[model samples]
Target: MIYRSFLRPILFRLSPEAAHELALDSLSFFLGAAPIRKAVAARHRGWPLGPIKRFGLEFANPIGLAAGFDKNGTAAESLAALGFGFIEVGTVTSEPQSGNEKPRLFRLASDHALINRLGFNNRGAAQLAENVRRRPPDCVLGVNIGKSHRVAIADAIPDYLTSFTAVYDVADYIAINISSPNTPNLRELQRREPLAELLRALQERNDELAKDKSLRQKKPLLVKIAPDLSEADLEAIIEVALNANVAGIIATNTTVSRDNLHASPAEVQACGEGGLSGAPLRSRSNEVISLIHRLTEGGLPIVGVGGVFTAVNAWDKICAGASLVQLYTGFIYEGPNVAKKINQGVADILRREGFKSLDDAIGCSAK
Candidate 1:
C-alpha cells in the first residue's frame, strides 16, 4: 500500500539505476544497526512459513533476492533485515567491470519489466568476498559467478574457476551463471560439451577446497540457465548438471526474446537489445522451471525466478516446481515489503490448499 501509493512514485522519478542505488544506500545507512534490522524484520514478519532447506542451505523462507540486484554484497545485511530468506549477490567475475554503458537499464512501466545489458558489472569476486566477510547478511548468501568480459570462450573454465575459488569460503552456496545474454559470447559456454567440462572442473575444485578447509562437504554449486533455451538445450544442460553432481539449477537468468509483452514493439525496441526481465519473463521462466523439474524427476532442486511480484506469482512458481523462488524486477517494481507480502501470501495459499509443507506444494502444477 505505501510503496505503490507513495514511495514508488518518488523513486520512479529518478532513473531506474539511480533509484536503485538511492534505495540501497538508504537501507545500508539506516538499517546498519542490528537493533534496527531486528525491528524491521519484526515489523515485516508474515505467516510463520518457517525455514526451508535446499541444496544443503536452510532459507528462512522460500523467497530470495535474485542476483543482479546487489551486484556487490554491500547492503546485504540491511536487505536481509527486510525479510528475504536468502540473497544471491553478483554475476561477479574474476575481473572487475564497468558494464555496458549509460542508459543500459530501461523500464517498461506498462509491462512491469526491465531490460538490462549491464554486462556483469561489479567490483569483482575478491572485492565482493571481502565486503560479504565484513558485513555478511543474516540469511543464506549465494554468490553468483560468471566468466570475465575480457575472457574468451575457450578460456571460460579457468576464468570461472578463478571466481569460484575466490568466494568459496564466504558463500553458503555458489551459483554458476552461464546464461545472461548481456555478455558477448558468454552463452556459448552453455553448449553441452563446454558446460559439462566447466561444471566438472569447478566441482573438482570445490572438493579440493572442502578438504583444505577441513570442511565435511563441498559447498553447494548451482547453475543458473536462461529462459530462451530450447528443450534440447535444457536437456543437455540438465544432463550435464546431474552428471556433475551440482546442488541445483536456478532455472533461468533473463530472456533475449521480446515476445508477448504488453509494451509495444516501438517502446521495447527503443530500450534496445538486452535481457528482458520481470512480468514479461514469467511464463517462459515457469515453463523452464517445470521442464527442469520434470527432467530431473524431482531429484535436483530448482530455484524458480522471473516476473514474480506477489504471493500469487510466487505460488504459481511454487506450483510449477520451484523449490525456492527468487525475484529481481519484482523487487524493483514492488518495493521493500515485497518479500514479506509474497511470504505471507504463500503461507496463506499453502494453508488454503491444505498442503503438509512447501515440499508438498512443489511441482503441484507441473504435468
Candidate 2:
C-alpha cells in the first residue's frame, strides 16, 4: 500500500528504464551490507507456505523474479531478500554487448504494461558467473542464456553452449532463451529443427559436464518460448523438448502482439517494435499454458511467465497448468511486496478451492 500510494507515483515520474536502474542500484546499495541484507530478508521473506519440488530442485515458493529484471545477476541476493522463491538472471551471452540504443524500455501506465527491446544487454556470461559465485541468492537461481546478437544463426548452438558452460556451475537451472524479439532472428531458433538441435546439443553437454564434475544431478534445462507462436508451432516445440529430454518449458515470454491494449495505436507505435508484457499479455499467456498442459497431459513442468500481477492471476496460471510462476512487469508495477502478497493469496485460494496442496492444484482447470 505504501509503495503503490507513495513510492510508485514518485518512481513512475522517471522514465521506465531509469526508474528500474535507480531501484536496482538503491536495493543493491542497501543490501551491500550483510547486516542490512539479512534484516531485509527476515522482514520480507514470507513464511514457507506450500513448497514445490520441480525439475529435481525444491523451490521455497513458486513466485520467481523473471530473467530480464536481473539480466546480469547483479542483484540476485538483494532481490531474494524480497520474498521471491527464485531469481533468474541474465539473458546473458557468451560476450558482453551494449544492446539497443536508449529509450528502449517504455511503460504503458494506463494498461499496466511494459514494452522493451533492451536486447540482451549485460556483462558477459563469465561476469555473471563470477558475481553469483561471490554472493549467491538465498533461493533457487536460474541463469537464462541467449544467443549473442553478433552470433550468426548457424553458429547459435556453439554460442549458446559457451554461455551455458560459463554459468553451469553457479546456476541451479539453465533457461535457453530463444524467444526475445529484440535480437534479430532469435525467434527463428524456436522452429522445429533448430529447436531440437539446440536442446539436443545442450542436453548432451549437460550430461558430460555433470559427469565430469562428478555430480549426481545435472542442472535442469528449460526453454523459454515466445507467446507469438502458433498452436502448431507450440506442439512441435513440445515434441522437440520431450525428444531432447529437457526438464521443463517457460511458457510464453513477452509477446510481439499489441492486441487488446488500452494504449492507443500512436502511443504504442511510438514505443516502436518491442515485446509487450503485463496485463495485456495475461490471457494469451494463460491460453498457452493451458495448451501446453493439455497437450502434455501435465507431464512437463511449466514455469508460467507472462502478465502475472496478483495472486488471482498466478492462481489462474497454476490451475491452467503452470507448476510455478514468474513475474517481471508485475514486480515493477506492484512494488516489492508482490511476491509475499501473491504467495499468501495463493495459499488462501488453494484452501478456498479445496485443494490440499499446490501440486494437486496444478492443471486442475485444464483437466
Q: Runs in model 2 with CA error above 4 Å? A: 47-50
In angstroms, give how far residue 256 of model 1 lies from its true place. Answer: 0.7
Candidate 2, residues 1-367, lDDT tens digits: the string is: 9999999999999999899999999889989888988888787756356567998999999999999998889899999999999999999999999999998999999899999999989999999999989989999999999999998999999999999999999999999999999999999999999998999899989999999999889899999999998999999999999999889999889999989989899999999999999999999999999999998999999999898999999999999999999999999999999998898899889988998899999999866
Q: Where's the lowest-lDDT run of ten residues in candidate 1?
A: 43-52
Model 2: lDDT of residue 17: 87
lDDT of 1 at 246: 93
lDDT of 1 by residue, 117-168 (tens): 9898899999999999999999999999999888888999999999999999
| Best candidate according to lDDT | 2
